[model samples]
Structure formats: C-alpha cells, structure tokens
Target: MAGRKKRAGNPSPGPSGGPGAPSPTLLVRGGWILSMAPGGFQGHGDILVREGRIQEIGPDLPRPPGASLLDASGAAVLPGLVQAHLHLCQTLFRGLAEEMELLPWLQTRILPLEAAHDEKSIAASARLALTELLLSGTTAVQTMETVHHTQVVLEVLEEAGVTAVTGGCLIDQGEGTPPSMILPAGRALEAQLSLAREWNGKRSGRVEAALCPRFALSCSEGLLRECAAASREKGLRLHTHAAENKEEIRKVREITGLSDIAFLDGAGILGPATSLAHCVHVSPEDRARLRDRGVHVVTCPSANLKLASGIAPAAEYLDQGINLALGADGAPCNNRLDPWRETRLLSLLQKVLAGPAALPPGKALETATLGGARALGREKEIGALEKGKRADMVVVDLEAPWLGPGGSPETRLVFAAGPAEVRHLVLGGKTVVRDGKFLLWDPAEAAARAREELKKLLSRAKLPS
Candidate 1:
C-alpha cells in the first residue's frame, strides 16, 4: 500500500452562500473527465478545485481536508458551455415574434417590444434567460441587451453568478426605429462608457461590459466610428451583428456603398477583440478580412434557420482559420437558450452543406467551449477543464436510454444529450445546478414574472395580448 492513492473523506458543508463569498475546496470524483485540454480525456478521474480554480486533475486526486465531495459517478464531466452571442433582453418575446424574416422581425416586433421594456420587465427577462442558461449547462456568455435598462440586466447577471460580457444595443438611426430606443451618438457612447466603468471587472471579474453597436444599418457611421475608438481606448470588447441576412446586407450596401463587413472594417470595428454574430452571408473577401483581422464569428444555426437566413459556412470558416464559436442568439429567434441544441445544429448543418465528414461532434463541442472562450478573450481562464483554469464545468448523466452506451462521450453529448440530461453545473467552483435543477434561482418564479411582464409589455407596445 506504499503507492496507493488516498481516497477522499466524507462530504462537508464547505462554502457559504453568495457569489462574492470565498469558494470552498471541493473534490469531484468518479466521472469521465473531458478536460478539453492537451491532456484529453480521462476515465473515472477526480478533479480538485480550490479557490474557484482547478487545482489538480487525475485518475484519483486526493481530496483535501474539509473539502466538499461531489459524486459524479456515471456522469460525463466537461467544460461548461459558452454562448458567444445572445440577446438576454428578448427572452420574453419568444413565440410572440414568429413568421417573419430578419428585417421585418426586428422592425415590426423586436424594436417596439424592446422600447417598451421597463426596469421590472428587463429584470424579469434577464432572470428568465439566466434560468434557462444555467440549467442547460451554460456558465459564460457574451450577451447584448436592448437600448434601455441594460443596467438591470447586468445586475441580474451579477446576482446569478454567470460570467458574461454584456452591454446595451446601440441604435441611433434607422427606419422604423422606435423613438425611445434611439440615443444621440455622443450620449450613447458616454452612457456605455459609464456603464463599463461601473461594471467592468466587477464581482472579481465574473462580469464585464462591452461596446455593442446594434449593426451597420441601425447605427450611423459616426456612432460606429465612435464605438470602435472607445472600444480600443477603454479596452472593452466590441460585439455586433454582420451579414446575417441577404436583404440586410443589401440594405447596408445601399446605405454605405459597401458590404456589411467592409463598412464595419472601414468604421474600424473589425479586430481581435471584436465578435460578430451571424456571418451567414459573408463574401470571400469578407471571410479573408475576418481571418486576416483575427475576428471571431459566432454562428447561431437555430436562429438562422428559423428566420430563413441562409446557412453560414461554419466548416469553411474553421478551415480558413477564423475563430468560430456557437450561440443560441435570442429566445425570440431560437425559442430556447440551449447551448446543447446549438452544438448539435452547428455540426448537422455543416454536414448538410459540406459532407458527412465535416465538423465532427468533438469539434462542434470545441466551438461551444474553447471557441467561445477565445471569442470572449477568456480562453486562458475558463474554456477547458485544465489545471489553473476556472472550475466551470458540467456533469451530464449519460445513462439515458436514448443516449444508449455505444457512442463516444463527445458523440453522445453532441448528438443525443440536452438540457434534460444535465445533472449538475459548477460555476467558479460552486455547484449552481444539481439534479437538473437551478440552485441559485427559481425557474417557476421567473416564469411567472416573465408572463406578467410580457402581458404588460405587450400592452405598452400596443400589440395584441
């Protein structure tokens, strides 16, 4: 017994409540660990977490004194999913804005509804989105809120303990733009910078701010240039949509005498710190610019397909060495803020466009994890289950009958599993979801609040209730 590995002792009541509280030492044992790191996979391994970071990972890591024990037997442990593009403000609009293309969808439904959001409605929407995201195994996201009440959403994100980079959608000029939603260029930039100063690096870096110009068509050249300049000056990330739809692209070209990507580039918005969602209609030149400028492209397959937008060549983007990530977009467009569904669609769509060999299951998983982390510039901190990385991971129950036991863990996770199979979710070394239930928030209460807010929001917008 000289070389025997010591087993962990009994579970202890480790850390106290609250997101700012110190994390407890924890031992997660007996799971199939997918590190998503250079070490690859380990069977029935143990992971030690201390002070919100992964301390050690191996076949049998010794549990420290007074460490909490989480039994992960018959589970698959992988890095928590990251959503690179989401509209947390639109969660309450989920089934209300159906049967429309991209431009009409925004002009007719999304803009007015967004303009109607009060502080309570924004808080309810953020809570609803957060509930679905956490229960579905997403620990980090880059979300864009509507023009007003963004601080409410940021507060909700901080309280929920989800890692995020988010800010208000900047819209100043466009046809049918709600009057309340449009702010002058100078005022908009000043407001966003103020928010960044107040919230960026708050909660020990768990939450941050970004400069989000709504898009080329919705914002004037002046506002876009200002945002680009401020992004560099303040060292904040720039997020927006580009070339998502053919009609939108055409409109952008007509307005600016340049394609969406080219106009964004001319405005100085394309860079390594910027992430553009829905690059579904990029030209070859646009693709080259994206690759050359080291920009990130987030593909929202479900939203694209739902809105009848053409498929993005995600496999081709990967081949072109563009940093690619996955996202659910928004609840109104995608109808569900589920990263697993995005992971599956990210692969299956490629197979349809390219071939059977394109974008395998494992690579799709990487887009949701490592690729998303890179998009948010947090690859070194939170993407993988590696030592010294933040301990944000998901424990998925692999015993479902539909999952069967035949395929590899990655295959099962990408092709068969979903939110229903997520057994536990750990964020910053604390268990946020257990037995498929969210521990830090109440889904039922969130649902009720969303319903109330939706009704009031519809009345305010003068839409049918």
Candidate 2:
C-alpha cells in the first residue's frame, strides 16, 4: 500500500446507491444479461442492484425513486470471471523460465528469484496482478503467495476490494532444491495458519485461506499429511499443484510408486474441498478418482501453453463430470493475466487435443464463470446474474470490431475480447473497473515497480532453454 499512489483517472462517477454518498439506490437499465442459468443467456433484460444484491431482473423494470441507472444498454451482463489458480507474487518473473520444465523452472529460476525478492517487490507484484485481473473482469482469484510474506498480498487484495482465497507456499527442503526455498516447512506452515486466523474470513467472507503445499516433489509425505490435518482442523481448502508436468509426476511415482491422484488420495489429502491446479499429466484413473472424490480442477491454459506444460484434457474431465474452472496462472508465464483470454484459449486447446466439436465456446464461458464458482464452493454467492445472488457481474462492451457482425455472444466473449475489450466491470455491486480503468488502484505505478523487479530476477536466473 505504501508504494501505490491514487490512480490518475477519475473514479467511477462514484459508487451508485452508497449510503453516505448522494445516491442510495441503483437501477442498471437496458442490458443483454447472460444469466448463465441452465438454459443460458437471458439476452434482453436488466438487473436491479438495490444494495449489492440483485433485486430484480426483467424487461422494462420499474426504476425506484433516487435510483441511479447504469446504462448497460449495449453490453452483455455476464458473471464476473473467477481465477482458481495463480501465483500473483510471481508476476515479477513471468518469462524467467520460458524453456525449463516445471521442477527446474521452480528450482532454478522461480524459487531463487522469489526467495530473493524483498517484501516491497512482492507487494508491488500482488497489487499489479490484482489490478490487471480487475480490468480483465475477474471478480475473485485464488492467489498463492511466497511462504514468508503472504500478508502483504492479502493487504493488497483488501485495498482493492477483491474476492480471493490466499495460500502460503508450503515446502520442506533446504537449499539446492525448491524446498530449500522454505526450510522447516512446519514452522512456515504454522506462520501461514497464524496469518490465516488473522485474515481468512475478512472482507465479509470475500477472502479466505487455503492450505497450499507447493507440489508433491517439493514436499514430504509428513509435510503434506500435516497440511491436510491442518486443513481439516481449520476446514480450509487444500490448494496445490498436481502433476503439472511429467518430471514432477515421475518423481512422485518413484517416491511413492503411485500416480498423482493415488498419491494424494493415499496421503488422505484428496477431498471435496481440494482445488488442484493444472492436472495436465493426470492419468485416466486419476481423473476418475478426482471425480469420485469431488476434487475441483483449475485449468491454466495460457500458462500451460507458455510453459509447454502439456494441455490438460479439460473437455474429457468435463465429460466425466469433474468440476472444472479457469485461471491464467500469472502474468509472466501467460505474459498477461486475463480470464477472457483464458476462457478462449482453454476451449481452443481442448479443441486441439480432441476435435472441433469438443469444448464448445459456450462451455468455455461456463468454465470461467459457473464452473469456477463451483470449484471455489462459492456457488450460492456468484456465477450468474440472478435476483438474490451477489451483484458479481461484468459488462462486455459489444462495440468491438469482432462483434461488428453480431455473432454469438459466447463466441465473441470467449474468442474475441481480451482485457482491452472489457470496458466496465463490477464486483459485489461495487464499480471496480469502469470506462476500462480501475476505480481505486493505480496500475501504472504498480506495473513499473514489477518491471523493475523482473529485470533483476531475469539477470539472476539461467534462462529456461
């Protein structure tokens, strides 16, 4: 918060229906609402937000007195995007390990740089990542933090008024390996839990903690079991990387003689509350076990492609009834953090793996919104534009060049629009991004700070070849 200055752009005309402020009510008039309901896309309707929850939705809704109307006439009111996996603090080293595999990338590049990065740099990266997400129409994100200083990231999230589940890196090694990045994993995890107690349920349940063990190879069975026990004790979700690349999977197999899912299941870690990121190398049996155990998979398409982590068979997972969500991973690997791009890329990747008929455009939209909400267990609160639900929605400006012929909104939304096309966005009935600008955060300063850190990080690491 220290480095961040007030954004130069004028704030969103002020929040509508604010109590102390002049406006005490708001009526969002005339918008093509993509309800995300069972049938999909309530193309012509309006949403009324009285006090941060939708009060009504229909044609020509009655505008209450003292109500300020958000003129969403030319936009599609879709649910705000949810990012199920990301290391926001890693924004400083996005392209550091462009060629190395996952384990080496972490051990040689990511871990060393992250360990060296000061607290100020970590906070700067977090702020920049959150600002980019807001501009890209993300309502919530499950962000991972460096083991030592997660509070800084949570602080940045609070300052931005974003919904997020945070995880502190859990590793059990010392020097020469990624676990060396955080020695004495137990103490590190304990600190994380202590911080969790302080910040988990803050922002009116908008933020929470997840027990994050970095990966199988980076941790010992004892450490993972301890983390699972802690998660059970706290009823917190378990967030971890699982079988992201082949080398990692091979290490787990050698150590345990079990595939990824079997290893986690045997460790007594897999559960309904588990949010596993990048199940690209998971086996068929692993997929079945994941479904049976109700494990949610958060697919990071952009990062997977950039890192060559092997595209996950997301379409097959969806067909098997496994819950799926979307994430961009982080800015460096993705070179950008935008859910709109993730949604499109995830679908197209599935198509590349399977066929054109697989992973349709509308399905991709669902993965980013509804599926993501389900993955985070925030089903009741988010994932749609409906009365009685939280006012978590994004307005896609339909005036873009791709939408000129007025094709299907699902196609246009997933394929055409990136962060640039997201003109206005709202999270929990508050204006976070309007006219393509942040309401409270200054992204330019945050980005500049991150770039400065990136240069130093790259210079230190052996570039992935």
Candidate 3:
C-alpha cells in the first residue's frame, strides 16, 4: 500500500490476481535498466512484460494494450538479487545464538532448535524468511532446510511466490550429532529423491529441488556417494557446506584422509552442478581442483565474520576462474537475510583481502545476480533483464542521501542502497511486492506468528525464549 504508485490507466491483474484481477501486461516505464547481461543497461528505458517473460526493452516503448503501467521514475531497475546459499529454517533463531563458533553454535543452539521444529514451526520460519527476502529485493534463493518437515518449507515457498532451489539437509551418522538429526543414509536419499520427484520443477518452473548433505564431517562416505549418484541420476544440483571452519576442516581431513574438496571430489560430488557453501579454509590445491572441476563457491561473508570463521579467499577464488555467488547464510549466523548487506560486506571484505580494485561495484552486483543464477544452473533464465528472460527484478529509489549524486547506478546499488530503498519487486512478471509491501498478507501478522512459534519452539527445546 505504501509503494504502489497511482497511475491513470486501470490495470487488470493476471493469474494470481483475485477478485478484480489486474492484467498480466506490466509496463515498467521511465527508469534506468541494468540488465546484468553484457551491454544490457539502458539509461532511460521502458520494459514490457507479458506471461512472466520480458517481451521488450528499449527507449520510448509504447504501452501495450490493457497493460498495467508502473512508473519507475527516479529508480534503478535491475535483476532481483539471487542468493545461492541460505537457511530458511533458521530464520526464527536470529538472535537466539550469539558469540559462538560454528560447531558450538550448531551443536548447542541451532541443532536443538532444528530438532524441535514441528511442521507449524518450520512453516512459520519459512514464511518469515520469505517475507524478509522478498521485501529486500531477493527474488530467488537456494535454501538448505533441516531434516524433517521439508515439505512444509516448500509449501511456504510456493505460496509466497518466490523462486527457489531447495532441499532437506541430510545427517545420517549419529556420532556427536543430535539423535533427532539422524536418519538412515538410504532413507535420507529416498526422502530427497521423493521430494525431487514432487518439486524439482514445480510452480511453472519457478521451484526446483536439490540434494543437500549437512557437511563432510557430519555425513558418512556412503551418504555422500548416494547424494552424488542421486544428483546425477535426477539431474539435480547438490548444495552443501564445505571447509567453513578450521576445526571442521581438520575433522574431515582426519576422517577421509583427504581435504574436504578432495574428499568431495572423490565422492563424485564436485562439479558444475554442485554449489559448495563457504570454502573459507580451502587449500591451494582446492582452488585448482575447484576451477578444473567447475564447482561454484557460495560465500556468506556476514555469517563467516560473525562466527569468527576466517574470511573466505573470495578474491583468490575469482582470480582462479571459479564461479562465485553470494549468500546471507542463516538468520542465526547472519542475523539478517538482507542481500544488500551481504553485497556490501562481500565488497568490503574483498577490498581488505586484496586491494581497492579487488571487488568492484559492478563485479559485486554480478555475483549477486548473474553469478547466482550460474551457481544454480539457471544462467539463461532469471538472472538478467533481457528480452527473453523471466521478469524477476527490483526497483530501487535513488533519492536517498547515502546514494550521493548517483552517477553510476551499479555503484550506488552495491554500496549505498539497501532494503529500505526498494520501491518494488517483480517475480516472474507478478507484482509479489508492491510499493514496499507484500501483497499477499500482512507482514505484521506474519511477524507475530513467527514470534509465537519461536516461543513455543524454545519452550519445547527446554530453552529460554
């Protein structure tokens, strides 16, 4: 209600539209278009969207008949941010676990909270995360969920109208693991495959399923192999953690007698279709192998810094020609799901690690957009605002003082702008977030449900809420 602009034409809604439905033709006019594709930006242009795909993009485009005009004056229109690694299940535990290392954090607070999650709790968590993501200009994500009630998370994602590649986290070995987190290797594979069968390409191709093993330390060799085999068989992507912390890396090396990347490669799980979160502790050999094997490295800068996990060599990885993408990780670790924060942190970290030119604004923006789509193997579809690509994009108001004179849109977007400046977000040509508000339901009500659910969950886990 706050961000929806008043126009002269009466717009008709399309498929998801209820009651007085607005038409599917969305005419986004009078904005600078940053397409994310090569030579894709236009200084002053208009976009015509129909049936969820961008029909045309150029200057002075005539509004299509029956089209709903969205005035984008004084805004930058670009592809919606894509997060390659995230944890929607942990959105409810934002401030519950603080000042803890990765392993301790997981074992003490995160695991118990995950173990205590029932269907309702998981649904609440997913809804909270999705709402935050949509409002922050993130139209797509690759979410790694906990063991049970994964269907509930998927249902929430579908209902929220966000594009995602998701899977249930697998943890079969019981040693040093919570009992509730354990599942038989074969059983876990079966469950994931079942989920893929049901959801790999659901929601008119907006949703897909992936195979996510918790990590090398927590999973057995058998489970890792099965995950690899299943991914190959089903043609699905593999998402998992790898070498985030020093202790975790040492444990994996001791168990498999190989580094984490080598072990994963030996397990047939490292390749173009795989997206490994956090390679913070990768060895020199890890870089070569990752480049040659074509694995995508997903970096979560905020979470790593918060946990005191050493900064990932993102600059080095990019130099080695490894495909890189950005993520916010989980709320407990990152404390927020805002992509703008992640982008700014990523840019700042690279500059500290290398130099002033290490990560430019344009490069950082690409990592969140095109690089993310590449990580998810969706490079041809939704990352950019091209003629044939899906209309998943965000409109950012450039009037904020932090954006200072605003010569380069990409520079301001990466360093100065934030979620508060997001005026509108479009997902698959549908106005899921309009005028800085979610159209489906009250965000206040969703936040309330999240608090109530988190209280019940902490009580169930015997922890203070």
- Which candidate's lDDT is highest? 1
Candidate 3 Cα outliers beyond 4 Å, as residue runs? 1-22
Q: Which window of 10 residues has the lowest lDDT sum in candidate 1?
A: 1-10
lDDT of 3 by residue, 62-157 (tens): 987767766677788999999999999999999999999988888888988899999998999999898899989998899899999999998888
lDDT of 1 by residue, 212-274 (tens): 999988899999999999989889999999999999999988888999999999999999999
Superposition error at 8 for model 1 (Å): 17
- Mark the regions of model 1 whose C-alpha exceeds 4 Å error after superposition: 1-22
Against the hidden true structure, what lDDT does model 1 obtain? 0.88
1-465 in candidate 2: lDDT tens per residue? 111222244233644633222234566667788888787448677777866787788889888876665667666778888898989888877665677666666767677778766677888788778878888888888877777678888778777766788878888863346343666767867877887788776656778777888877777888888888888888888888898888778878887899877888888789888889999988788888999999999999878887778899999999999999988887667878888878888888888899998899888988898888887778788887777888878877766666655778777777787777676677677766666657665678777888887666556544555
lDDT for predicted candidate 3 compared with the true structure:
0.86
Off by over 4 Å in 2: 1-24, 39-41, 178-180, 452-465
When 1 and 2 are scored with TM-score, the better candidate is 1
- lDDT at 224 for candidate 1? 93
TM per prediction = 0.95, 0.91, 0.95
lDDT of each candidate versus the true structure: 0.88, 0.77, 0.86
| Greater-TM-score candidate between 2 and 3 | 3
Better of 1 and 2 by lDDT: 1
In model 1, the Cα lDDT at residue 235 comes to 96
